[model samples]
Target: MPGSSLALLISPRHKVIHHDGREVPDPTKNKAVMKELGKWWALLKDKRFFLLVPVMVGFNWNGTYLGIYLTRYFSVRARALGALSSGVAATAANIVWGYVYDIKAISRPTLAKSTWVIFSVIMLTLFSW
Candidate 1:
């Protein structure tokens, strides 16, 4: 019964539709084999997927450095408390934003770009000293 409100907002059950608009069963096997890993290389060779690598890395790098630099504004115990508060804030943000996005309070693509801009501003404010 936990998360039932979220469940009611969105159904986990859905038909899988292919790119060609055919409804097909999802693959039962979740694990990928080494042989199948070549598909990623093929994608990169064909000039796909690789473009996302930088975006992924940029977000991670920004978050890591953001934490590091933010802690500089605090003493030892203050840093620890700041980290704790930051973690709690992150959890609250995730739950609230997940619910908001699930209810279409904001469009997914717009939310994504907005978060990027917000984080960039936060980073600039924190680290531009």
Candidate 2:
């Protein structure tokens, strides 16, 4: 805040909108309602949320466990290179997925679920081998 030319604080006089699309009468109410949404989305809106949420849970859990496996299976140098390659591949995959979803108008949930299944199969095959 010391080096900023403009004032860092919001004045209490300003009006803002609540996340739920209601008007906050003054700046004082803004801080309380600035969150993305006041309530969680009903899963009924899109059936996909139910599936994607579990996939996300599994991804987080498996990813943490994967670090231990990687360290145990590979040499220090191999592990480092694997990490680098994985990062690059992940970035590339993200870009491709984004482009395909946006430009191609693909169904996001179907794509996500199918990809997860395909990857899981590949993982199981590799682990078994």
Candidate 3:
């Protein structure tokens, strides 16, 4: 449900009619629709489009856990620094992975499987420490 809010943010509205078919959207509404369409169009043109959502989800999940671990296992100052460092690391990793996906045309399944393997390895290492 992490990305579920996207539906609310970008969902299209539909009109229902009794007898006749639904009328076309108002010009004002069409403007908003066109703007949203343009944004999507731009995204599609970008090479990194395929990686955006997955990287976002991965970063969010890892970031939340990193913050929690820092709070529980370290001093307040250390936790703060850890959080900052983790944020930078996650951002960099996301960008690199995105580039890899774009340049290599990696499939989603392969990306997902690799993500799990990497996450598991990281988790095991962190837990052992």
Candidate 4:
């Protein structure tokens, strides 16, 4: 039921035709409808949304890699402590990021571009070690 409801909500618009080919519904009239639907689809289809997927994967991988590497290099207790510390560090970082976003002094696109650079640097650092 939920899946069907989701599908109904997300289904794309279809053009209908009149019988006898006399006249059909104007497509320009449907532009508003399509635009509304596109807003929902853009959650996944938009370039910005898709770009974040790989960044999230890389961030998670970095955290996991750091945890496992620390464990192997040190002891299990040390690894656990390191992981806990990393979690706290991530939370603090997120808090700072949220504050910047809430302040709204800069546009979102500017923030996103800066964040892309920061994410790239983080990934490079993670992979270099």
Candidate 5:
């Protein structure tokens, strides 16, 4: 199949690095298995991943409920349209929020306070409806 065969033509020209500043070993080359495992273990021990557990769980739970609601209340075509619109809206929101959050001129404390205010307003508006 063309889909399966197309992947064979692609190759990474550069070395990959882990988030914790470790270089990822190329699978094509022989390396020590225990050293690689140690790197992975170090990454697993990072506190940041654990901190995101609740957020990850909530996202998945919300998505599951959204899927159920869509299927229950919408026709096939309407469901597809709703999914596309939701995806586009989410992307646009992320882009706008990224721009707001990345404003380098704003002091971190000011930005954090503004973000909290905006978030609170949005959440209150949403929950009030």
Candidate 6:
């Protein structure tokens, strides 16, 4: 996989040491499918995971609809442009949101709630229109 290859190229193969003189074990050292599945199950049991399901579904539904609309209604050139623009816009949004989420001025919970409110307002506006 590209991700594994990139990790191999970039990550240190030896033990990781923190500035506070603590040694951290490499996460990639041990590989167990059953253990991974157990961790996945634990995550699935979390209330946050259940809450995130609908949000993910809505985002995926909109993305699929947008893709279908572009392919069905636009010419090849137009569709290509649309796809490129969509990718660029998504990338830009991710970068902007990453910085916004990392702001030290606001509390994490406050930031999370504000983001949810903004998301809900946007969704409502789009769907209502």
Reference-based lDDT, residue 69, model 4: 70
Q: How high is the lDDT of residue 72 in model 2?
A: 82
lDDT of 4: 0.77
Top candidate when judged by lDDT against the true structure:
6
Which pairs clash inside model 5?
A: none
**Native-referenced Cα lDDT, model 2:** 0.68
- Clashing residue pairs in candidate 6 (N, C-alpha, C atoms within 3 angstroms): none
Q: Give the higher-lDDT candidate: 3 or 6.
A: 6
Q: Which stretches of candidate 5 lie above 4 Å from their native place?
A: 1-37, 106-129
On TM-score, the stronger of 4 and 6 is: 6
* Model 1 lDDT, residue 26, Cα: 45
| Every model: Cα RMSD to truth | 7.0, 7.9, 13.9, 12.4, 6.1, 3.0
How many collisions per candidate?
A: 0, 0, 0, 0, 0, 0
- Tell me which residue pairs clash in candidate 4: none
Question: What would the TM-scores of all predictions be?
Answer: 0.44, 0.51, 0.38, 0.58, 0.54, 0.78
Tens digits of per-residue lDDT for model 6, 1-129: 667777665647355667698766767778888999999999999987775665677678778888898888899999889889989999999999999988999999999878877876776676666
The regions of model 3 sitting more than 4 angstroms off are: 1-69, 105-112, 120-129
> Which portions of model 4 miss their true places by more than 4 Å?
1-42
By TM-score, the best candidate is 6
Misplaced by over 4 Å in model 2 are 1-29, 33-37, 41-48, 104-129
lDDT of 3 by residue, 3-23 (tens): 987777753545434357765
lDDT (C-alpha, whole model) for all candidates:
0.69, 0.68, 0.71, 0.77, 0.75, 0.81
Prediction 6 global C-alpha lDDT: 0.81
Q: In candidate 5, residue 18 scores what lDDT?
A: 58
RMSD of 5: 6.1
